[model samples]
Target: MLFSSLLFIFQFLPVFFIIYYLSPIRFRNLILFLASVFFYAWGEPRFVILILISILINYIAGIFIERYDRNEKIRVTILVLSIIYNIGTLMFFKYFNFIIENINYIFKGDISFIDIPLPLGISFYTFQIMSYTIDVYRRDTKAERSYINLGAYLCMFPQLIAGPIVVYTQVSKELRKRSYYLKDIEKGLRIFILGLGSKVLIANNVGGLWDDMAQIGYANISMPLAWLGLLSFSLQIYFDFNGYSLMAIGLGKMLGFDFPQNFNFPYISKSVTEYWRRWHITLSTWFKEYLYIPLGGNRKGKLRTYINLFIVWSVTGLWHGASWNFIFWGIYFFVLLSLEKLFLKKWLEKNVILSRIYTILAILLGWMIFAITELENIKIYFGRLFSFSISEDWIYYLRNYGMILVIGILFSTPFLKKWYDKQANKILCNILLLVIFLLSIAYLVDAAYNPFLYFRF
Candidate 1:
């Protein structure tokens, strides 16, 4: 269920949190483990068995890796097998159909595609579980002994389906021992309200324009309209994902756990490199720690470093979806990042206004590539973005969505945050939070169909 939905906010969360708070501290993790499984099953009943089995496999794998620590060959072998199982599971469920279409195109064979659903949160929980076993193998952290503790850590509902991707090490302590605090709940609820506003009030409103453009047809849009639509999408995606991340974090805090920050006002960035550093902070960190650093990172020669970046970006794109467009999106960023690394960074830093403009344009174009899945449609959309065609249609759209768009852009920066920070402890601030919460609830009552953009991944 969507975190933004009235049903989740009104029914599921209230009941879950009440039961959670009443449970004994010793029983909390077990309660969470069971609740999370039920939460997943509420939406994806068919995948419950799949996730349970995957969790069991990883739980066993971690123990084995830790057990054979003194024997290099055995531990290494076990680690490799675990990696294969996790990656293989991801491949079969997420990419098997993607791979099939390509093979058919190449060999002209009429191979039937598998009719299987990608298990809910498989991408997220899989990575989290791998981090556990890999850390055990590297002796960075101990393998969790309690099956309930391990399961709860991996299945924590707050960030399970959509995540800032809380690494095992980040929450290992909390999984074993944590205390409830009223202050924490208060702060976390306010943060949750803020995220609720962002998603329901901002992202949902701005996303309508992009949906309109899609319904109208890409080729028919004027150049100005095209850019405006993409701008709406750029804002939509950032708020949609960012809003969810904030909710996840807020929930974590409420549960007496502190998840890492996942965003840093990426839109304000003046360079693509800076943007990547800010956007999806956790994912970037994950790749850097697990993938890039292992491939020697920048410690390698210049060519090797570039090659490592290429591999990371390619995989990063594929991680988002089982589509060629996603791969292109990754490559697009790779080229921009490579150019910035080569020479653009220095030049861009010299002029703030021009640099931000350049970065914004680059990001909007990238969003265009990301939003459209079909290559031919992507090509048409790109053509429209630069077509220089003129129309009054864009004026109407801007009139309709201009305020939310403005709020989205302003909110994308630290402006609201700065103001909020200044008045955080004041009574007015408390009232404002209440108003935001109430208004967000009201919005959901009328419009409860919000869909998470990253749900596909």
Candidate 2:
């Protein structure tokens, strides 16, 4: 169920929270596990089995890995089997159709497509399981012995669907022993309300602008309109995903777990390298830790480092979706990042205004690539973006969405957050939050144009 949906917000959450806190401390995990399973089953009844299979496989594998730690061969074999099972399951469900279509296209064969329904959050939970098994193999963290704790961790509904990709080690302690504090609950509630406002007030509203522009057709779009559409899209994606991350983190806090922060003010960065560090911080860290570092990373020398980046980014793009355009989007960033590492970083550092302009333009262009999937459509849209043309429709949209665009841009930076931090007006803060909450509720009640863009991923 979507966190923004009234069913979830009004019914499921209230009921779950009441039951969760009322239960004895010992039965808390059991309650959470059952509730999470129900939550997943509510949307994906058949595919809930897939998640259970994953939990069982990883849970057993972790124990075996720990049991056979003294035997190098047995331990390695178990770890390798666990990785294969997790990745193979993910590949089959998420990429099997993608692979078959590509094969048919290349060989001109009539391969029957496997019409498999991708289990919701398969990509996320698969990675979480793999991380746990790998950590167990490396002896970085102890294998979780309790099936209940591990199951709850894997199926935790808050971050389960879309994730900061919570690692097993991060919440292992909390899973075993955690306490509820009034201050933490209050803080979490505040963060949750802020995130709700961001998604409902900013992301959903601006996204409608992009949707309207898209319906007008790419070929007919003028240069200014193209940029405007892209700007709306960039803001829409940022606020949507970042808002979800904040809600997940806040929910984690309320449950007495501390999930890591997923995003910083990435749009404020002056370099592509800096942007990656701030944007989707957890996923980037995952690739660096599990993929890049293992592939010899920068320690292997300059050329190998570039090759490693290429491999990482190619996979990263594919991870986002099963599409060629996503791959191109990844490579596009790879090229920009490589150039920055080579010499652009030095040049950008010397000129502040120029660097900001370059970074923003680069990001805007990248979003253009990421937003469109078909090659022909990409060509047409980009042609318009650079055509230096204008139309009356561009002016119309500007007149309509100018204030929202301004607000989106301002919120992209840390201006409001910094201002709020300096204020000692607790009452003022509460009042503002209440206003935002009420506005969000009104939007939710109307339910006009709410879209969670990253739901597929």
Candidate 3:
């Protein structure tokens, strides 16, 4: 059930919004709660029970943690148990196959391979539930007395499928009391249309270029062609995931709930540390508040701070998937960040152009690892990126250079909205926006298949 799909845009979303708004304010939560359950179950019916069980377990755990607040030992025990339970469920569902496959390969163990069905949105909802329990344990938020309110918060369809990882603290007050204003709804609609346009008109088209370049065998890839593919993929992923985030935020606004901004023009960043601060702001904040802070953070000496930073990022990578490539991707960023903190900062400040070029190259290389799955293929791709493969022809370079330039320039700034807004005449802005909106719909209708990258994680 992709948000970009026609079924979602024309059918599910329209129907849900109409019914939800028409319902009594008192029954709004129930309407959304039931709709969310149906949304998840529609795609993976078998996982519905898993979702219920996990919700029930955490809800109970949260209550116990709140109940035994005076007893420090009891509170700690319950908190530890709840954390283990949530993580254990995640491990069994998400990583059991990943673990068994590795064991079989390393020791030639006679482990029978069994297909495990991954529940739709399990990673997202699980984290939501975990955050709730942890917050209750820390006394940051009270355990919700009403099961319905808590349930709705966990499985709210928009962020549930692919999230900005909304936590209990962010939405708890809104869940209890919220209002809908016409102005807010209008603003939300505009944001939604803009996000839809980004996904359909720009991201999907760039994704086609990425797919075309990928289909060209790696052996035929030149350094220029390699750079083109990397740049295309980098932009494709940003637009796809960030487009979805914008839509999610718009939906939250429409419902009179404010969701945090997930991206802050990350490509414009001069440093990896700054980039993380801007990109996926919610997730980085989560890791910092929960994992890094608990591990002593920067309150300790410089060496320990670096160690904690590395551990947090490594876990962040592993959280994305149970793959060695993701681990490398995490470490790859860690290395650059460490270097920037250690020596590159002063050097880059003195040489601005070289610094910018170096940062772009490092980021482009990181995206290559992220885009590919296998280690050997990544190695071969990296070799070509450095012109180690001499077989590529001039046609390859000429054909892709223009597309690469477009992607690079687009990713490098936030020009579209600025340019449109610069037209001081309101009528002109509205006319252009209307045209873009219609074109986006046409592009979406014409494309048979469009996929978002972050949905897998």
Candidate 4:
């Protein structure tokens, strides 16, 4: 269930955390594992079995890899097979229909596309599973002896669906030994409340403006409104995903597991390369560690480095979805990042304001590509964005959404966060947190547009 949903916030989470806190230390891992399975099953019951397959396959593979460590060939073979299994299952469920449709279009063949359902969080949890096996293969970490501990690590509900993409190493120790503290619970609750405000108060409210533009038709929108609408979406996606990440981190904190930071005020970045460093950080770390470095990261040569980037970006694009637009989005960034690496880096670094403008504009256009799936609609939208057309229609939306947009813009940087930190322990700040919590709950009570955007990925 969605973390923001009233049912999850009020019912499932409360009941589960109560059981979790009351459970004895020895049985905690088992309780967490079972609760996680139930959580996943609540939304995708059939897929739970498939995910169980993943857990067992990887878990067993880790053990075998560790067991056969003296035999390089055997260990390597197990690792390769496990990788193939994880990637193969991900491809079949996520991209089978995507591949079939493309094939039908190209070859004039009527291949009836099977109705396949993607398992919930397959993209996320699969990466975590593969990381564990690969680390064991690399001797970076030992394979866990306890099946229940591994199960809980893989299935923990907090970062299970949308993640900071916690690697197995990050939580292996916590699985083996962890302690609960009242301070951790209070701090986690506070962080969660702020994230709720970010998603519900700011992201959801501004997101409606974009939806309105879509319904109103991009063709009829003036150039100014097109930019505004895209900005709204930019804010919507950032806060939506980042807010979800924060909530996940907070939940992790409460459970005595420290998850990695996912975002770092990416909008403040002056370059796309820097932007990436701050945005979806764990995913970047994953690609860098497992894929890029293995492929010989920049230690090779400039030409090879560019080629390496191309491969990473191509895979990164496909990883987001089984769509050409996502591919284009990846290539778009690849080109920009490549240029920055080649010549523009020096100039962009010196000119902060101009670089930020350039970075944000480039990011917004990239989002435009990401926002639309159909090429024709994408063309029309871009045309509107730059047609230089004038209309007073934008004024109406600006009036309606201006304040939330301002709030989103401010929060996207570190300004609000720094200010909050400065006043963190003050009575006013505490009251503000309470008000945010109460308002978020009220919004969820009557919520309309509360979808967590990254769940599809």
Q: Per-residue lDDT for 246 in model 2?
A: 89
Best by lDDT: 4
**What CA root-mean-square deviation does each model show from the true structure?**
1.0, 1.0, 2.2, 1.0
TM-score of 3: 0.94
Root-mean-square deviation of candidate 4: 1.0
Q: Rank the candidates by lDDT, best first.
A: 4, 1, 2, 3
lDDT string for model 3 (4-91, tens) is 7778888999899999999988888888889989988888889888877877888888899889889989988888888898889888
Instruction: Please give the CA lDDT of all the candidate structures.
Output: 0.91, 0.90, 0.81, 0.92
TM-score for candidate 1, residues paired by index: 0.98
- Per-candidate total of colliding backbone pairs: 0, 0, 0, 0
| Model 2 / residue 268 / CA error / Å | 0.4
List clashing residue pairs in candidate 2. none
lDDT of 4 by residue, 257-374 (tens): 9999999999989999999999999999999999999999999999999999999998898899989999999999999999999999899999999999999999999999888888
206: Cα error in model 2, Å: 0.2
Worst 10 residues of 4 by lDDT: 444-453
lDDT value, candidate 1, whole model = 0.91
Model 4 regions lying over 4 Å from their true place: none
- Candidate with better lDDT, 1 vs 3: 1
